[model samples]
Target: MAFLIRKDFPLRGFATCGDCGSNLRSSWSKGKTKYYPYYLCQSKGCDSYGKSIPRDKIEGAFADVVKTLEPSPNTWCGLKPCSDVHGMRDWLKPKILRV
Candidate 1:
């Protein structure tokens, strides 16, 4: 029997490598009493390819990207509620609820 370990990080599939254009992967390093998260690019032959990026740094940068994405009212008006999910299950819920 074989088992696989999977690490699910927030930016796992969302971020791409700046050098080789590969998707970034994330993992945790075990410390004396705790675990630390890090993101890395797995592409071969790229500089800084396998180097780990500290979780706080990567996550902070992602947060900054999110901060700059406030949609204008016109942009909001073009979106419709998702038909696949029930009430309050769409991405626009928070903005809708505020009004």
Candidate 2:
């Protein structure tokens, strides 16, 4: 009752409530014979306040939302240079222009 078996909060800062706009809080809860993870809104007076949503439900929805998100070509271009091998190549290549 005072401690949790699972204490990780993967969505704490990223997931917010639709009604309250407050960041969702996660916690481990006692359920019959097992401890279950949950996401909830702790903002007072909000419609979702104190309502415990299962971790799987929220994370599944989060995964689905991001499933269709593809980085643009520009993103790859920008990140390519940030990668170690590419960065070294760019840095080591000749910068002088031949006349």
Candidate 3:
């Protein structure tokens, strides 16, 4: 099958292969009746180098990880104001003064 670059793959550069520690690349395959999305490791010497993982499975696993990361409200509140350098400097000023 001819391979084409797809921009819709959300995890293209973000996901990594468990076995090879290489970034996972995604592509679409034309089946008999439909197109299927898959993520694969392209590393030359890795055990799972050419193995394809179904898109749903990879995305679902990412979703599961995101679900488990429930940051507390206090942490969010603390970080919300430090979104920029000036804000971070201001936030750190008080702590530095105390130290």
Candidate 4:
């Protein structure tokens, strides 16, 4: 029996190569505990290695981007309630958000 190897970032996910003009390939390195994931250029003769950017840093940046677009209480109140799935369902029932 043969198994297929799947990659996280596919061909469409590649942005661009730093050194070469080709597309960059993403891979992960096996660490002692977890895998160290990164993206690298597939072009030959390129001296550039995988960027050192981590997953958490990217997530934080994305959160900051979302925070910038957040609406104030006054502006948010004017919007109509969405569908049942999207709207608050019995927010008055109980509150135990914090530990």
Predicted model with the maximum lDDT: 3
Off by over 4 Å in 3: 1-7, 78-99
- Displacement of residue 43 (Cα, Å) in model 2 is 0.6
Decide which is better by lDDT, 2 or 4. Answer: 2
Question: What are the runs in model 4 whose C-alpha is more than 4 Å off?
Answer: 1-7, 10-12, 49-99
- Candidates in order have lDDT scores of 0.63, 0.66, 0.68, 0.46
Tens digits of per-residue lDDT for model 2, 1-99: 122223376555556787887767788999899999988899999998999888888878777766766879886676544457444434423331110
The full ranking of all candidates by lDDT, starting with the best, is: 3, 2, 1, 4
Alpha-carbon TM-score of each model against the true structure: 0.66, 0.68, 0.68, 0.39
User: What lDDT tens digits, residue by residue, belong to model 1 across residues 1-99?
Assistant: 111324446555555666776666788899899998988888789896889888788667767766777778898687666564333233422332110
Q: Model 4: per-residue lDDT, tens digit, 1-99?
A: 122224453221323454665544556778899898655666567766544444344335445654666567897777666554223323311221110
Which 10 consecutive positions of candidate 1 have the poorest summed lDDT?
90-99
Q: Give per-residue lDDT, candidate 3, residue 93.
A: 32
lDDT of 2 at 85: 47
**Alpha carbon lDDT of residue 96, candidate 4?**
13
For every model shown, the clashing-pair count is: 0, 0, 0, 0
Which scores better on lDDT, 1 or 2? Answer: 2
Better of 1 and 4 by TM-score: 1
